[model samples]
Target: MEKLRVSDACIGCGLCVAQNEKYFEFNDEGFSKVKQEDVEENDKEELLNIVESCPAQAITIEEEK
Candidate 1:
């Protein structure tokens, strides 16, 4: 499984959540948050889109062990 992480750079733009609601969500302060560490492999592309869509460059994907 892989986990999506939101860095400190997040400006709370909400773009990541907007791109893929299944994987990403917004925290109370409006920053991007990963709802799950495990996602279908086919959804990777959409996750990529979420990463790119983040205006604050706060999103990242990493393998989970």
Candidate 2:
């Protein structure tokens, strides 16, 4: 399993959302939020693409049991 975490450093740039709306979303304040705290059995490389695209460096994906 993998978990996506958004940090307070997020400036709400929305890049993560733009990259992958299925895994990311825009809140009322327009900040990008992770749609799911965790995902199972998927392409981690694609997820990493979205996380790494975050200019704010707010998104992170960590492997979990």
Candidate 3:
């Protein structure tokens, strides 16, 4: 499983949560956060799509060892 990370650059645009609520949510500070980091292989494509859709480019997928 890979780890999904949201950087501090997030502008709280809510695109991530709007696209996939299962994997993302807003924190108290209103920044988009990765609710779950252990991504399954089947969901990688959708996750990548969300990453690309981020207007602030705050999302990233970290390769697992």
Which candidate leads in lDDT? 3
Instruction: In candidate 3, list every pair of residues with a backbone clash.
Output: none
lDDT of each: 0.79, 0.78, 0.91
Worst 10 residues of 3 by lDDT: 31-40
| Per-residue lDDT of candidate 1, residues 4-64 (tens digit) | 7888898877777776788778888877777876767999888887777777777888887
Residue 28 local lDDT, model 1:
84
lDDT of 3 by residue, 3-53 (tens): 899999999989999998888999999988989888888999999998899
Residue 21 lDDT in candidate 2: 73
Clashes of 2: 0
Q: TM-score for each prediction?
A: 0.82, 0.80, 0.92
Pairwise lDDT winner, candidates 2 and 3: 3
After superposition, candidate 2 runs with Cα above 4 Å error: none
Clashing pairs in 1: none
**Model 2 vs. true fold: TM:** 0.80
